[model samples]
Target: MIAKELHDKTPDQLRDELVNLKKEAFNLRFQQATGQLENPARLRTVKRDVARVKTVLNQKAAAAATDA
Candidate 1:
């Protein structure tokens, strides 16, 4: 998913996505340990995406705090 799209998601949705991504990352690691992972780069991409979502969430929170 794109950063813009992630930023646009509602808080609940973003949190849910973050949880799912973390689960997937865990599964990917398990697969790697079993030598079943075909694309290890996918793990890196997911980690970056998780960070992007977190950044956007923090940005929104900061903006809200400032406005209040």
Candidate 2:
């Protein structure tokens, strides 16, 4: 879940991870809305993780574009 780990992954893998994180985030929001969320703090972590994944993905894309 760290930027260094994400940087080592291929773009496809990063995309997949991003998809999964987004799904988790959606589910967390739903749980919060229903007031059934056990760990409300999880929502914050998931949101940050999503942002981290996005940042890494953008960095990878920029690197590729410059390489071309």
Candidate 3:
């Protein structure tokens, strides 16, 4: 997913996406540990996606706080 797409989502949706990404990241790590990971690049992609979601979430929160 891209940051631009994420920016269009509501905070609740972003949170849900974040949760899903984290779960995937966990699974990816487990697979790596077991030497069963098919694509090592996927791990990096997930990690960056997680960061993107988090950055968007933080930006939303900050904007809300400023508005309030």
Residue-pair clashes per candidate: 0, 0, 0
Clashes of 1: 0
lDDT values, one for every candidate: 0.90, 0.92, 0.96
RMSD of each: 0.9, 0.6, 0.5
Winner by lDDT: 3
User: Arrange candidates by TM-score, highest first: which order?
Assistant: 3, 2, 1
The residue-by-residue lDDT of candidate 2 on 1-66, one tens digit each, is: 678998899999989999999999999999999998999999999999999999998998999999
* lDDT string, candidate 3, 2-51, tens digits: 78999999999999999999999999999999999999999999999999
Q: How does model 2 score by TM-score?
A: 0.96
What ranges in model 3 sit over 4 Å off? none
- TM-score to true structure, per model: 0.92, 0.96, 0.97
State which candidate, 1 or 2, has the greater lDDT.
Answer: 2
Model 1, residue pairs in steric clash: none
Q: Write down the lDDT that model 2 would get.
A: 0.92
lDDT of 3 at 7: 98
What would you estimate as the lDDT of candidate 3?
0.96
